[model samples]
Structures are given as C-alpha cells and as structure tokens.
Target: MSVQPDLFDRSLFRIRRHRALKAAKPGADFLLRAVAVDLEERLLLINRTFGTAVDLGGHTGLVTQAIVNAGKAGRVLRADLQVADPNLPLPDLVCDDALLPLGDQSVDLIVSALTLQFVNDLPGTLIQIRRALAPDGFFLATLPGAGTLTELRDSLTRAELEIRGGAAARVLPFADTRDLGSLLQRAGFALPVTDLDTITVRYDTMFALLNDLRAMGATSILKDRSRTPISRRVLFRAAELYAENHSDPDGRIRATFALVTLSGWAPHESQQKPLRPGSAKASLAEALGAKEQKL
Candidate 1:
C-alpha cells in the first residue's frame, strides 16, 4: 500500500511558532492565553491534585502558569516542539508531539493548550500522551475544531480559484468535536468527555485578521501548499470576498473560531465504567407500556 502524505509540515510549524513567540507582539497570543484560562477553569473542577504533570506543546508557558496558580500539580514540566528560549521562567523540555520524552505512566496529569491540532499524527500523539499518564490521571485541553477558520478558508479558496485557476489546501483540517470522543476512547482514555464552544471575533478588514493569524503563528503549514508566496492581488481579492460574504451589520468581518475542549482520564479500576451490553434491567417499552413492533 502507498504511504499517506502528511497533512502538515511539522518542522515548518515549529519554526513558525518559534518565530511568532520571538516577535512578542502585544495581544498577539490572546487566543492561546484565552484557551489556557479556560483550561485552568476546567482543571479547577477536578477534585484531585496531580503530583507530576507535563504541559505538552505549551507555547510561552501560559498554561504552565495557570496550572501552578491553581495548585493543580506538585511539579509541572513544559514541553514543546521547539525550545524557543531556555531562559524563560518555566522549566522547559523540547520534544516531538508524536513521541513524548517521558516514561510510561510517569505523569499524573497531562494538559495541552491550543496545541495538538498542528500535530501531523494526532492519533499517535494522543496514544503517546495516554501512555505517559499514570492510571486515573486526567487530560484536559482546548483545540481548534473543524469549524474554525471556515470563513477564511472559503475566502482564500475562492480567491485562489479565481486568480490562479485552482485552489490549494490553505487551511489545516482541524478535528471535529464529533470525532474527539471516539479518538480518546481509541487512545485508551476512560470516561472521555468532549464539547465545543464558538468564539467569533470581528475585525475591520480581512488584512487585520490575517495579520493576527500570522502573529499567532497560525498561518497554514500544509505540506502540499504552493511554494510561491501569496500574491498581493490574491490577498486583496480574498479580503474583498471575505468582507462581502462574512461582514456583519457594522461592516466588520466576523471570524468564527470553534474550540473543542476535551477531558478524559487514564483507565483505572476506581473510575466509573459503563455497564456491559444487555446489562440494563428495564426497557423504555416496558416503562412507557408502549406496543412493540418487530421489523
């Protein structure tokens, strides 16, 4: 069988994220910080405190600070695809997403913030995370869902097709919330729960939105993207199309970012488990006294 092509270039993505962090623009990482805040809130809901934890792909260490502030962990190690600065306040460890550096069942908690979506092998990454977590250990995270950046993707594709007679994959295909639970289960997580929330931010123009994406190190790193730089004419036309189709009453363009928050625990006997098939004692037909029809 032919090997499948990678959806993203992991090396390029790491470099872009490092570049964005180096730029250090004010409010450029507002989205990442926002997700970290939300993740911290969710972590607060868990009653247990972890002894040792790792924040995988923790860019700029915002989530690490959140974990520390909440007293969620006795020790939190920060890991990322690229080590942008070793002198940062947090203790940092450089590692790849698919293969974590920790030993099996060595961590009590594993939290990721605005990461995982960029991984070329998401399923493998989750499996590795599961292996790193001790029994009953928790996993919490917020990542971009399939609906994220839909407007921009549409606008760009339309512009490319019109200007260059074709469209390349310009946006990463983020995982859908519907598939999250299944993936967690497949990765050996217990009591996995997933939900999505949409955040719509309005911008004066498409250029502003694009600028924010670049500053956030979120520009497309699709492996099969066109080697040539984006032409100015194409960008202008895409901006025009975005405004025409996605503009609100105030003349501001609306960008929808659907974030999927996932929570799961490593399997342990103490954790609750679903009953076996055919274990239920009652049926709806009996409770409601409804007539049963056979197919």
Candidate 2:
C-alpha cells in the first residue's frame, strides 16, 4: 500500500510546546483541563480499577493527575515529547506518540489527552496503542475533532484569498468521529466507540485567540505550509474578517472546540460480541408485538 505524506512537523510541534512553557499563562491549559474533566467523569462510570495506566502525551501531567484523582488506576505513568518545565511534573517516558516504548500487553490502560491530532500516522499509532494494552485493557483518549476552530480557519482562508488572491492551509486537519471509530476497530479493539462534545469560547479579538492558541501549543505546524511569513496587512484583515463574521452580540468573537473522545478495549474472550448473521435471539417485530412485513 502507498504511504500517506506527513502533514505535521513533529519537531516544530515540540518546539512550539517548549516555547509555550517559557511564556505559559495561568489559564493556558484551559482546553486540557476541560478534556480532563470529561475524561474523569467517563472513568468514574467504569467500575473496575486498572492495575497500571500510561498517560500518553500527557503534558504537565494534568490528565495524569486527573486519572489519579478519579481513583481509577492503581499506578499511573506519563509520556510526552519533552519536559518543557522543570517546575511542572515531567513525563516518565519522553518519546513520540507513534513509537511507544512499552512492551506488548504491558499496560492495563492508556489515556491520551489532546495529542493524537498532531501525529503523522494516526492509524499506526492506534495499532501500537492496541498492542501496548493488556487483554481486555481499556484505551481512552480525547482530542480536537474535525469541527474545531472553524471560525479561525474560515477567517484566515478568506482574508488571505482577499489580500493575496490565494490561500494556504493555515489550520491542521482533525479526524472525524466515524473515521476514528473505524481506526480503532482496524487496530483490533474489541468494542470501539467515538463521541464528541462541542463548546464555544468567546474572545474579545482574533489576536487574543491567536495568542491563546500559541500559549496552548496549538498553532498550526503543517509541514507543507507556506514558508512566506504572514504579512501584517493580511493578519489585520483576517482579524477584521473574524470580528465581522464570527463576533457575538456583545462584541466577543466565538471559537468552537469539538472535543472527540475515543474508547475501546483489547480483545478478550470474556468481552461481549455481536451475534452471527441470521442468528437472532428474538424477532424485532415480536419484541414490539407487531407482525413482520416481508420485503
């Protein structure tokens, strides 16, 4: 099979994150914390405790701490690209998401927070994650989905087109729910599921939103992006377009974040499976007390 071209610059992604640490604001991790809360709630619903858990791409250990705080896992370890801050909690294993160092069936759980979208080979990474899980082990992750940052993408493309008569990909692509669920199944997970939650964050201006994106280490790092720097004229025009098009009644502009959550389990004989075709436990019409209509 042909290989897909690398879309993201992983090195640049790491560098941007390290730079964000130096100038990290108090609320720079707002998105991470939001995902963490939802993840924690999901964990609470699962009854059993994990013997060991690895928090993949868990920068600063916020999700790691959340996993611990949820009282779900007996022991938790963290992995990331680098240690951006000495004062903050560092990763237990510093490595790429696509190349996990853990052995086969070594971990009872793996949780990734807002990281997979940057990976160049997401399907391969999912397969690696599946291999890392113990039999019946759980895998949970949260990342920005296809609809995240619609306003910024629209504004930037329109502004660049209007100013320079052309546009480049200023936004990174994100996976949709259906594709991710299929990936999990392809990775050999027993019961793969994907869902999303959308939230809008309002900002006073586009510049402020851009600043926040930088602080969050979420700026575009597409490898094929144009080398020419964005001119101030184009930048200002983009901001104006953002304001004019996406602003709320109170004057603040809206930025949408669609957080997709993925969950699955390693295959095991004990797990539930779909029945064979034409082997029904009961007739659907009979269950509803209605006669079946022949096709």
Candidate 3:
C-alpha cells in the first residue's frame, strides 16, 4: 500500500502556537472567545449533562472554561499542542489533535475550537475521536472553513505571481462542509450535521489582518511552503491589491472567516435513526396530498 504524505508541518505548527502564546495581547483571542460563547449556547440546548468532557486542542482553554461555566460537565480536561498559556489553565494532556492519547469510550463530550483545520490527517483524527467517545456521546468542533481568508489568499497569490512569476500554496486549504458531513458518517457517528458561519472582520489595513492571523497562530504551516522570506515588495503590493479589491467605503479592508461547525453523536440504540429505503409507509404524493406528476 502506498503511504499518504503529510500535508502540514506539525512541528512548525507547535512552534508557531508557542510564539503566539508568548506574544499574545488583548483581543488576540477574540475568535476563540466568540466561538466559546457559541459553544456554550449549543451545550445549553442539549438537555443531558456530560459526565466527562474534553476540550480537545483548546489553545487558551477558552472552550474548557466555557464548558465549566455552562455547568454541563462533571469534569473537564483540556488538551493542546502544549500548555500554550499556563497562566490561563493547564492542559491535562499535551498532544496533537491527530494523536489523541485518550482511551476508547472514555469521554462523554468533546469540544474543539479553532483547531482541526491544521490537522494533517483529519479523517483519521475523526475516527479516533469517534472511538474515544462513549456510546451516544456528543462531539462539537468549529474550524475555519472553505472561504475563511479569501481576501488574503487572493492578494498574496496575485502579489507573489506578479513579483516572482510564480506562486506556491500560501494559504492552507480549509475543509468543506459537505466533506465534513461525509467524514462524520464515515467515522461512525450518528445524526451528523455540519454548517458554516460566516464572520466578516474589518481591518484598517491589510497588514493589520496579517498581524491578526499571526497573533491567532493561524499562519501557514503547509508542508510544501516556501522557505524564502516574503520580500517587502511583495508584501506592499499585496496590501495594495487587497485595498483595491476588498475595501469598505471608509478604506478599511474586509477579511472573511467562514467558521464551520460539526456536531454528531456516537451510535447507540437510543439515538434516532433514519428509516431504511422503501420502509416509509407514506408516499411523497400522499404526504403532499397531491398527485405525483411525471415528466
């Protein structure tokens, strides 16, 4: 069998996360906090409380804190690339999302925020997550989806092509909602659902958007990334292109983040199941109370 090559550099991702943690400033975790609030609302909708919950790849423990504050979990343990921010809360396990050490059927709930987009083997990781979840357990995760950084991606690609007559993959490709839904089913989850949440953030300049990505530890870590440093000419040109193409009337640039949410439950007898083909008692025409029309 042929082996699949890794698409992302895990070591570089960890190093970048460490740097982001060290240089983090106020509002750097704005996305995480926002997602945490969203997750809390989701958990609130569920009536059952979790016996053991895990904040998988929780960088600053914001999701973990949210789980605690929701009062829906009996115990919450955090995990990440490292203890990115010890000042906030330490992780019970330091591990990559691809490599989970948690035992099979151990956790009742698992919530990951702002992670999984960088995982080299997302399908395998999802399978592992499925294995770790107890029967009828719940899983919720939010990550940057297909159209996360369209403005930056277009600007950078254009600028690089103009300067060097060529361009590499600067922005990592994000997961598609359809593909994620399929993956959830492939991983043996029941009642799988995936949806996109688009958020537009305005920045004074393109550089400001770049800095925000850096602060969020979301910079490129592609395996085939260029080793050469981005020159000033390219950076400035990219900024100019960005302003020209994606700017508000007030001259602020627009950056789009399409956050994708995936939610599912481990298979169990109690959970709802779809009816088998040809098993439905009522036909579509009968349900609609109209005769079926043939084309």
Candidate 4:
C-alpha cells in the first residue's frame, strides 16, 4: 500500500547527519548511548540470543556495541545512511533507513535507535523491517515520541507568529505513543508492545538545546520548512519565550524528550496467540460475583 507524502527532506537529513557524524566529539553520542543502554536492558529481560541481527540506523555503532557487550547477538551488521568516519570504529554498510538491504526472514533480530522518526514513510519502513526478520525474530527500537520538543516547538511557533505574522514548520513531527502499538500490529508484528520514557533535560539557554540537536543530527528537516535561515530577531524572541515558559526554579530551561520504546516479534505459530471467542470457561460476572444484566 501507498504511504503518506514526504514530510521530511530525506536528502537534507542525510547531508546533516553526515556533517554531524564528521564533527561529532568522542562522547557527543551520549544520548544514543543512553538509548542503547535501555535497549540492552530490554534484551536482557527477553533472555533470548539472536543468531544474526541488523542494527538499523546504528549511529556511532553504540547500539551495536551494546548488543555485543550484552552477548545478545552472535553476529550483528550495521546499516546507516552514511559511511562512518574513518576515525571512528564502525561498520561500512551505508544504506537508507526506509529501504533496508536485506532479504525476507534473513535476520533474527533488528534494533533501531532514535532513527525511525526521521523517515518520511515510517509505516512502510516498519513493514520492511518486519519482512526482513525471521519468523519469531525480534524488532526493538526507540524513537522520539510526541512531546519530545514541546519547549522548542512552542517557542519557535510563538516567536514566528509575533515576528513574521506566520510560521513555517520548524520542528520535526514525532510518532504518537497511542498510535505506535496499532502501527506495529498493522505492520504484521506479533506480540506488539510499546512503552515510553520521558527524559527531561535542562539547558541553560535555547541555543544550548539547539546546539545539542544539531550535534545529534536531530535538527529540523521538514520538506516545507522555510528556505531562509531563521532570523536573529525570531531566534532571540524564541529564547526569551522558552526561558519564560519552561524555566525551572534554578533558571535552567527544561526540554522534554519522550522516548517511545517498541518491541514486536515476527509472526510464528509457535508464539502465543489470543484465545478464540467463547473460549473462556467462566464469565466475567461469575468471576466477579456480580449479576448479569441483559442489555
């Protein structure tokens, strides 16, 4: 089936992501590492070893490293949009996020980290991931959910409206927590589950947050974004608004990052299935000791 129109400038995202990788410091990927840590914890809970795995969008190979360190996967391949910097030790499989280069049922595990939110066709990508997994294989990922950058979004919107009379899309849209589970099911994943973790980061100024976003390759790449760079006047105003509305008692501005963690398995007859209708021996009314009433 066809998917939504391009919401993001995928080419631009790749260019920026490459620049971010080139200019990144040794520990600049702290956020990616944090997500990888959580991914490791989730894998530990499952206690299943994967024979072959793909680390989709494995920025800096942190997720790959986490999986390897945890001994979760026997062999892991890294796939990303750009070749890693030679200075950094990483795999060299450069590929698009939406079009994974893997055969059906080829991989036993797929782990994506903070990557799906940038794809223009997320549903299609998820379906592709599902198709690439072996039966009963696992797909685990974390993407920024709704409310990820509420402070920045609000500040930019208010600043633009007051200064330019209107605002163009300045922030990337994120997946909603409510819709993710259903999306997983639609993508033909079994035992679909989704949960969220909200990380509140404090920045001394709006510029600080923007700097971090740029370094993380998380800057706005909306297809319909303004061609011109943001003006200094609007930017300053946004900083003022952000501080006024989102500052804590200590005067540091709070930025909310809601990470939506998703887990699903490729369908297999061996996996648990829901009970059929009328399969239960006891009625809810009988179990709860309440009278049954006819509607």
| Candidate 4 ranges with C-alpha deviation above 4 Å | 1-3, 90-92, 289-295
Against the hidden true structure, what lDDT does model 1 obtain?
Answer: 0.86
- Model 3 agreement with the true structure over 1-295: per-residue lDDT tens digits: 9989999998898888888888877798898889999999999889999899999976777898889988999999888665456556556878878889989999999999988888888899999999999998999999999998999999999999999999878898998889989999999989999988999999999989888889988899999899998999999999999999999999999999999999999899998778899999888999989998888
Residue pairs with colliding backbones in model 2 are none
lDDT of 2 by residue, 103-191 (tens): 99999999999989989999999999999999999999998899999999999999999999999999888888899989999999998
> How many collisions per candidate?
0, 0, 0, 0
**TM-score preference between candidates 1 and 2, better one:** 2
Instruction: Encode model 4's per-residue lDDT on 82-170: one tens digit a residue.
Output: 55644456564878878888899999999999989888877888999999999999999999999999889999999999999999889
For model 4, give the RMSD to the true fold.
1.8
RMSD to true structure for each model, in Å: 2.2, 1.6, 2.0, 1.8
Write out the backbone clash pairs for model 1. none
How many clashes does the backbone of model 3 have? 0
TM-score of each: 0.93, 0.95, 0.95, 0.95
User: Model 4 scores what on Cα lDDT?
Assistant: 0.88
Number of clashes found in candidate 4: 0
> How should the candidates be ordered by TM-score, best one leading?
2, 3, 4, 1
Considering lDDT, which of the candidate structures 1 and 4 is the better prediction for this target?
4
Computed on alpha carbons, the lDDT of every model, listed in order, comes to 0.86, 0.90, 0.90, 0.88
